[model samples]
Target chain A: MSTWSPSASRDALMARQQMYRSIREFFYTRSVLEVETPLLSQAPVADPNITPMQAGQRWLHTSPEYAMKRLLCAGYGDIYQICKVFREGEAGKRHNPEFSMLEWYRVGWTHQQLMEEVAQLLQMLLAERFSTLPTLHLSYAQALQSYAQLDVHHCGDQVIARHGQALANADLDLDRDGWLDVIMSHQVEPALPHNTLIFIDQFPASQAALAKLANNEQGVLIAQRFEVFFNGMELANGYQELTDAQQQLQRFKHELQGTQRSHDALLIAALEHGLPDCAGVALGLDRVLLHLLDAQSIAQVLSFEWQRA
Target chain B: MANYSSNEFKPGLRVMVDNEPCIMIDIEFVKPGKGQAFSRVKLRSIRTQRVWERTFKSGESLESADIVERDMEYLYSDAEFWYFMATDGSFEQLGASSEAVGETIKWLKEQVVYEVTLYNDAVVSVTPPNFVELEVVETDPGLKGDTAQGGSKPATLSTGAVVRVPLFIVEGEKLKIDTRSGEYVSRA
Candidate 1:
């Protein structure tokens, strides 16, 4: 392997730069203020799965979620940031330990509106390849039924057991949300067609993370969250903001899997000070670039994936 | 043998699964947003020659397969068993399982030794030289003056592997064949 050379070609790199420039323009037209946040924090995220790279007493930021939310609480109406975030033990065709993320928050919009905006932005960015890319919406239940032919809410237990049978270990031990994610990521995401913006929305309430929960027309409690997948890659995840201080604290605890961080208290305080009703999202910029280039691996769009770095 | 953590996973690594030694063929890291991470992997069992997919929770460890690769030459088989000898003159277990021989068994030409992969003292795989010269043991008589550019016919080699060769090639003619594909390369 030529480690000395950049992972992406000069032409692809130029396209990336152009994509970045166009993204800024897209937000600028909407009057979304571009903002920057600290790359490291004194406290780590409780989300046990996302192990943050630590530097002595401080930990590198996983995503600008908490800090960006703090900004939202400080009354920064519509803001966006494109920055590099760090996560440990993630490397492959699509993942690098460190990757670029484009995060933004809107004061008066819902995740649904944000999803439409995302589709519009993608169409703007990929105008050269696609004249008009159609956006497809699928509720979490519809996605499972369409892709794996299983019901996420009703037949969850049996589906997990059957899905686990294929695994080497830890079969059927995971919770409902865990099984949904495993099946969704491995099956539904990649099977999505090219040039279509697929929005898988209304997640299970248990896996809500920081999103707000509401009942769908079917009366099942679902989280107001949606994920965007393009050309078989998960490009972005967004949520209708959760502003209840107590609820936010509980979600933070649930995210920490087992680790505890002092920032949880600070975030709770911010929520108590009142984060405005808003929707927010963090998109993987590298993956978006990969989709635009129609490249098989994320390395083709990134200047230096984890390997080269 | 040493154990391997999920972070150390890569292609070509051998690890035991359910007491059978399997080689890691492909692996991809998958982590759902804000959820448990997993390494989806594909493995081929040397004992059964069955390729299957498996998933492991991140941070999980695997037992080493105690596998080793050595340069060896293919020896004649005893009908039920195929044998090979290392370049250093050391004899292998004297019998290789059919599963270990794989499809390469069709191209196994005696005296044309190959590099063999072993696990726990049993031959699990053999790699033949890219090109091997074998006499065509069976084929229709060449059409008197058929040139190499004309039609082709099936020819059986000394290894019993059939390959399509130029119409000019007839029985008893030595031909070079690609062991990997069991295809005719050229007249030797």
Candidate 2:
């Protein structure tokens, strides 16, 4: 067995403590109530795009999202939680099988309002940690137009397929959303303002998974969600919740049919209990630490990764 | 013939390109988020000692290289080529163009075991010992109090290889040097 010395591990543990303390302090000062929820749930929400890790027939919480929304329906106003989440096949420089997630929600807020709050909160948190803050803002449509030379809001599947083929001579069979994600990561996200935090907003309605949609000035339906990125790394994702249970059910069913997975009945029951109109976001704690400390990989901030475990 | 996919690629994997045996030097996973994932690779030609880059899709397959590595003893080098004797008492020679051998020729010595790579039964490249111990033949005498300088001086070895030696080192001293990076190592 390879033995680990205390000196290196101690330093890492101390840094983790400092990061947790900073997060709590930030929320406390903002009057956001700190809450704790179960890590294991009888039935967890299922999304085709995200697979949940099974723990002995029970599902480990991929994100504290579903239960947190249940709390919102239970009359818990503004609240936040920093907890552990798990997903399989997510081991890499930026991902781990089990990771720390910081999620927060606000009542009576639009997606734009949530975006402004996230930007300010990040600025305050980073300034206290590093003594300097970097920030930038861009709309999703603007990024797609500038980098892919195609407006994602208006492009069809055929146009996206042609663009994907032109990207590399090799055959690439990709759908519209897949092409958009590829172009965003490779061409747009990397070219964003890297010295500071960048906020990407105004996503197309189809990609809104759980977020609410609103009509823009151009009559295009856009999701009320924003993603925070730093130095080409995705740090956080937030949404203005859709409170209409019927629409929520329809969305869930669509996801199930697309991925061919069974519906999550418990989440449906939670929705039946009535979720209030609110906005929430989940941030990657390890990725935030990596950017703040100028570390290369999320493993550097983590106490023990999957490989090490 | 069995086809090898890029997804099955790893270090030490050998593939054939244009009938030449090439070994993968590095494999990088690069995929655009929503598009076809690709493995970008750097490969070295076993026969020509040339390095080139190629990108392959995830499911694409490649042919294996017909190359072998053999241990041989270095014999001698003439004006045109360097000679080596196989374990079976057979001799094989490779043209050691100055550019091809680069700075490695300085460390070559007679009777030293070395790795010889062959492609299609023809010698392509020679790998010298990763580390070599050599005896310093000539150098200026160490000056008084110069040991405190912590600097190095030039010294010629018995193999005619010039290397940097510490001020405290003198003639007849043995030193280890890394052949790959051509850097000073330590006392033998």
Candidate 3:
């Protein structure tokens, strides 16, 4: 009756609790140690696209990625964390400024191997609610070609921008990667088949700094990152960890130029100390619950959305 | 002029686009995995009442449009303009052009309160109430038990608006009409 009450229903709260339990059980069976890190950090992410929420002199950690990598460097193998992540000004029907994230790392695993584990975990959790769906994997460039009829790797900026403009229905001033992102979200995502788990990997090299870089069979450079989508919702993102300290610092510096943000010195130090070979993924728990309950908005699964919080 | 960033956009927010005042009818925040965020919005031009969609990258800003809305009582209509007086006891009179009144002119009734939108202190649009009561001036006599057949005939209201009423309706009867659909609701 009043705004003081939570936006989630009683049943939704129960479903959320059940989801957490399932996630923890999944990791426990795999022997992945659960870890916790401080929500407040001394340094913010250097990614220009993400804005960190500041509290006094410190910033809220956008994700537990940095700290978890630190643990890996310190010889903690196969770690998982379930925590609340903060991103400023990201509220919408599917987004909340503060939302639950389930991040984990697997030692001695490739991004492709990690994808299988992710699919297995999702199947276990969504078994009772949804029917079994065949998991499909497609490279970013292949997905673009199949759905939008454009080659992301060889296409010129004008070609990509034209596609972006046609999908957005207006002219946009954007770089090549920005226009590719627009097409991925506007055209490729909506056109993805429903009732299926789709993973789009081999992102443009510039799009992912933390992920390792590799060349496809066509000899085109691409990032070893993948995204999971279901029912048109972006559910998770993952990477084959980049371990070279110097290369990592260069990427951070390149991204921080105009962002006016500082890179995490401790994270760099951890990389310098030798982070073990690993692959990691971060999944939006709230969004996963939205799919489980078949709800329309993220607020229906969150205990208190941004406005209420 | 004040400016609004993409994050500040929401439904009913008025902003300037292409040097024209438009209102945001819907906004959706979309971000691809590990990419820049964007705000997809549907805006309706105030002057032309035409709606179109646009996408703005995060942090992109737009100039704000200063607009105001108020309740006014309909007074009378001239050849080129319809007159109204402020209902807030100010007794301030304003004349809105025929373009501003648009299709609402068909439902206009003297002394009825209507919403008036002003841009730069000039009337840009008028909205009639959802339901208006008017007396039927012309219709055939009511047919006994015709309600069971669900048949209806045309009736003309005192405001010169025509609507379909049930066959049981007769002339000179007060009826509630839905201004949006021009259909008879019930006896007022």
Backbone Cα, N, C clashes tallied per candidate: 5, 1, 0
Q: What tens-digit string does per-residue lDDT give for candidate 3 at A136-234?
A: 999998899999999778878888888898877767788888888888888889999988899999998988769999998999999999999998989
lDDT of 1 by residue, B1-188 (tens): 78999999999889997787989999999888877788888998866768988888788889999888887778878877788877775564456767778787877887777878788887878777899898999998767666564577888888788898988777899998887777888999
Query: Cα miss at A193, model 1 (Å)?
Result: 2.2
lDDT for every model?
0.83, 0.74, 0.90
lDDT tens digits, residues B1-188, model 2? 56687667876898986576789988755533213355656788776678876655556788987677877777777768777678655565444444445456787778787787776676667788899888899999878676554677888998888888887788998889898877779989
- Alpha-carbon deviation at A66 in model 3, angstroms: 1.9
Per-residue lDDT of candidate 3, residues B36-120 (tens digit): 7999999998877889988888888999997788999999988789999999999999999999998888889999999998999
Q: What are the runs in model 1 whose C-alpha is more than 4 Å off?
A: A167-172, A260-263, B88-99, B102-105, B142-150
TM-score result, candidate 3? 0.91
For the second chain, the TM-scores of the candidates in order are 0.85, 0.78, 0.91
Instruction: Report the candidate with higher lDDT, 2 versus 3.
Output: 3
Query: Where does the lowest 10-residue lDDT sum fall in candidate 3 chain A?
Result: A124-133
DockQ order of candidates, top first:
3, 1, 2
Worst 10 residues of 1 chain B by lDDT: B89-98
Q: TM-score each candidate.
A: 0.92, 0.71, 0.91
Candidate 3, residue B102: lDDT: 88
Fnat of model 1, as a fraction: 0.67
Best by lDDT: 3
